[model samples]
Target: MSTVPVRTGARRVLDGLTRPAVAAVTVTVAIGLWQALTVLTGVPSILLPAPTEVAAALRGNRADIARHLAYTGYEIGLGWLTGVGVGIAFAGLMAASRRLRLAVYPLLVSIRIVPLVAIAPLLIVAFGATLYTRVLMAAILTFFPVTVATLDGLLSVPSSQLDLLRSVEASTWTQIRHVRLPNALPSIFAGVKIATPLAVEGVLLAEFLAASQGLGHAVLQAAANLDTPLLFAEVALIVGVGLALFGLVAGYERQRRWSDGTDGLGGFGTRGGGAPAPTPERALFGAVALAALGGSWVAGTVVVPNAAVFLPSPSAVAASLWETPDLFLTAAVGSLHKLAVGWALGALVGGTVGAVVAFAPRTRPVAGPFLVGARVTPTIVAAPLLLVWLGISFSAATVLIALATFFPIAVATASGLTTLPETHRSLLDSVDTPRRARLFVRLRYGVPTVLAGVKLSIVSGLSGVVIAEWFVANGGLGVLVNQGMRNLQPTLTYAAIACLFALGMVLFGGTTLLQRRLDW
Candidate 1:
């Protein structure tokens, strides 16, 4: 009996090791298959280099790669710090003034909605192709998410706590320092984590579009020469930077006991306490916001010499809008179509996979690594490869959009499924419900969470489409932006950016409305 028990324990240990073993096997097989495909098909190295060739390129150009990496790192660091500082200041101002919050919050959100990639070229034109331009691009990318997150955290203080502070005669600044800031630390850290990879991506985009330094520039150069091995090597280095930054923020988050509950999608699970109801006050605030924006444009044009070269006057942008309505309309429609198609596809596939992983526990270990890779890999780094594989076409742009949209949806869907009440699952299990029925029920329960992810994905998908168009595709707002920058037409560039802003507002607003209607 004792010997039999010992044998059973040994078998159990082996069973516990099975999943890891299988995962290892799966990875090895996948890599082997990739190598086999390239070797057997006689594909040109320019189209898709072998992994070994990539490794060799990495070794051959290690010094150059490292130098470029340092440049990118410096740019990202400065820009991130600048953006975070500005975000903190803006958030503080909004928190202090109710009128300011009401008048300017929507405007800030609108700016946040615009894809930075689409406007990177405009930034180049405005700031010139200098380090400052790259840093500004990165800062622009970092600003919105950080500001929104910081604002969300600042406003999340409970009314009771605020009331207590008020009764004690605490000033606004005192309340912020003593209560709000501490309470918002977790959220601010969460936002920092969210902004980290984005900062890296922003630097890459700026380098690609403007700078002659950094990994992005190297990638572009390699692609131009059809040096696939070198291209892959540079991309891997870019991914490394992204992952390193992500890891640093994540490590800090863990140390602070902050979990990535919403997978870096801001305002997903947070309540909007400072949001004013639609009333005459809000109407007045809106009017004030428009006036402020108009005044700023007027001031820029009047106060600055040759302001149109950098900051095009609103009238100029409007005139461009009127003069080339079809051009703007067609580009807008094209980009929107690509975004819609790609976002839908990504959501469908990712949601399905997430559901499967949640229901089938046996598959989690096997699928986990690949999902993590997808989440961490910078899509910008892969843009050149995609251009090679799919060519300069809508298909390539759509693929990039899909990749950009997939990760958040999957993570959110999986989270939703896993967090379903045990009692609910037990009830379903008691009835011997079919697997499909169980999945549907879980999805229905998680609709709100899924919608939150959809909102984030809308922005991401838009950004991806713009990047793809800038690099590969011949149409869409990205192409228009490139054309504008090349021709030195600030009006055209600003008009395209304005259209992108409008597109973002529509998609984001529509999703939000749908979420409210569903009451999810």
Candidate 2:
């Protein structure tokens, strides 16, 4: 009996260790396969280095790599902090004073829509290849998510709760602390999670544009020198750092949930699982916001000269729109076509792949790691290699965008499908629903999640397009902006920028409205 007890304890230890052991084996197999492929191709080492070679390079250059990592990390940390801080401050300001939100919202939206890559080079030139440029770019890229999400979170506090607080004569600060802050935790955390990865990626982009130090600059140098092993090593480090940062944010958010009365808010599980308390002032605030925005537009147009050289009036832009309707419209149409096709194809392929792997018992183990890889690999770096392989064609651009946008949709869709309500699944089984009907039910329940992912993918896909333009393509907005900058046509560059923002807002706003309609 004592011997049997020992055996049972050993078995439990082995059982507990099984998954990790399997994971190690999987990684080993992958590395072996990667090495086999490299040798089989007999290709230049510069094109696709073996894993061992990359690891060796990384180890040999640890000091240099560490320095670069630290520099890049600093950029990301500072920029992320600044963006989140400013975003939260702005959100609070906007929430407290509707006029401020309205006056600045359009410009903020416009700034958000413009691709950071397009303006990064300009910032580098202006800021003189310093850390400030990278920080600014990172801040610009991450700010919108935090600001928008925080604003939504703050404004999303329920009217009934506010009334209750008021009934107890809570001060504004008291209400915010006791009511709004808790309610906004989920949204703010969601934004923080998004900003986490973006901050890292944005810093890399800015460094690539113009940095003497940092992992991004290292990658660029390695690529330029055809040192593929070093390039991969740098990329790997960046990815690891990004994943670490993202994991930190996610863990903190999880802890926040645990500490916040098991639900995000205290006794108000509203938002998704529970009925969200309606904002008492949403309608009135929205009206005031729009009015203030319109007034600013009027002021901008009326007070600002039509041809202000650097900053043209809205009417001037409208005239420019008319003057080169074909140019703007055609480029927009081309971009949109590319975006829609790429996003759709990526979604279809990714969703199907995720679903199949998730549903298959054996494949499920692989799915999680695969998704993580896809999620962390910055798709922008792939653009240059893609351009090299495929040339400056629309196909290259579309493929880049597709790959960039696919991961989120796939992950979210899989998550939704895998976590269906037990009651709903039980009901379907009880009704003896066919496989097709069961799948349909699952999909319907997952639509909101799918849409949410798609919306985010669209946002991400636009960034890819901008990156694609930076490397390839001769006639897109990227090309136009590049040309304008090369020729020192600030006005034209700004004009193109304005158009880009308009295009982005159109896509974003259109998708938002469509989602709302679908919800209805």
Candidate 3:
């Protein structure tokens, strides 16, 4: 009369159905809570529309939503394809030549670190807010991740494999085709997955800035009119689009894993193995690359007719910096302060929640769905609604930054906590360690992963601050950018952008150095 086989079968079935079951239950509870709050609290529909109201709005405006979705979908599709193409090509080139990698990789990294919002206005000026501008913005956003991912994949082919190819006197192309490409496919798909949602974000940001007929535009209009239900509907649509794209990529990745029978791809892991010893060759090439960039900027401004109106010369931007040092300094301080505060708050909250979920296995099933939703929901779409709810203020911006910073930290913290060695946990349990002591030990062991998340949060916080300022706050680089764009002062706009880029580099570089020092 043994029930072991029946128990094992039950366990298998439970494990197989757990994820979807959790997700379904979470959604049901969330919708119920939303409706309950609105109905029981007597909150105005303008402030917090009930779930039913949102559903009605969706039903009433299906045609309009569909139209906008179509436009955004087109932009996302075009921009994503273009970005993947360019990224793969550039990654291949950099992989092919050591000198090129040394000379250009730093520049690419810098460009990628600079927030697109900082340059969106400049792009609008240069490209006149056309479909091209939107496409380019999306492409720019999608490019860096894909390039880095592909480059990592290309370089990750085992030395043994390379040697094998060399022994056969394989040409570089043959080596890549036979050895690198197949090995890199998983990583490339990983990049594609990362890039897909970002492509949606890029298009939404562009639409917010310039487009007349997209979900972004609708969001702005909804905010302006205080049409809460429509705003929710639009945001819902945007989230749906992002999730759809993300799901497609995730499905592909799952299929790939099943097909390849691998645990994970090498290239999908963290970049820059560790801090490298400084080299003269790297320094020299970096200098050369910077000089070339400056030279190109100067030439574009001086040689092209009225190019200074859009793409101002370095000297002109430098002059603007000199003339308005106070303005730039004030804005930089405001942005940095907000970013710091918001990032700290987000990390604190995310870490606590993640720790709790990790410690309480039962809680994870309930929390997982909400975490996924937060991670996928674009902060830009939430910004306008926040502005309306919270008003145009620093608090609003800080909230946005917190929202942007929270999910990554939470995910990282959970990952770090869950990955603790079983031996460590067992030893603590055997010793009957206090809960607090066990938690402390877990955090100490997880510092490296936590810090890695922090490093990422730095950039996320910076971007959040900029976008929040663009929509809500009166001070910061975002204000400088908006005014410069409206007033048609390209020099001021470019100068503000340059300051932001420098600030980002400093923060990002410092974080990287700290993470390295910690051997994270």
Per-residue lDDT of 257-324 in model 3, one digit per residue for the tens? 72322111122235651113268887898999999988888888878777867887788889999988
Highest-scoring model, TM-score: 3
lDDT to native, each model: 0.81, 0.71, 0.79
Report the C-alpha lDDT of model 1 over 1-520, residue by residue, as the tens digit: 6799999986686468765486676677777887899999999998888888999999999999999989988998899889888977888888888888888777777666778777777677776888988888778777777777887788888789989999989999999988888778777876776777778888888888777778989999988888899999898787777777777777877787867476665543235745755678877897899998899888988898767676778888899999889999999999888888888888988898888887777667778767756766767877899877887887887788888999888877877777668999899999999989887888777877777778778878888888888877778887787788788787888898889989988888888888888654
Better of 1 and 3 by TM-score: 3
Cα deviation of 250, candidate 1, in Å: 0.7
Each prediction's TM-score against the native? 0.90, 0.82, 0.91
Clashes of 3: 0
For the record, the alpha-carbon RMSD of candidate 1 to the native fold, in angstroms, is: 3.5
Output the lDDT of residue 245, model 2: 80
Q: For model 2, what is the error of residue 22's alpha carbon versus the real structure, in angstroms, after optimal superposition?
A: 6.5
lDDT of 3 at 85: 93
Alpha-carbon error at 217 in model 2, in Å?
Answer: 2.2
Best by lDDT: 1
**After superposition, which runs of candidate 3 have C-alpha atoms over 4 Å from their true positions?**
1-16, 258-270, 273-278, 422-438
In order of listing, the candidates' clash counts read 0, 0, 0
After best superposition, candidate 2 residue 116: deviation in angstroms? 4.0
For 387-437, candidate 2 gives per-residue lDDT tens digits of: 445768888888888987888778667765665689988988898999998
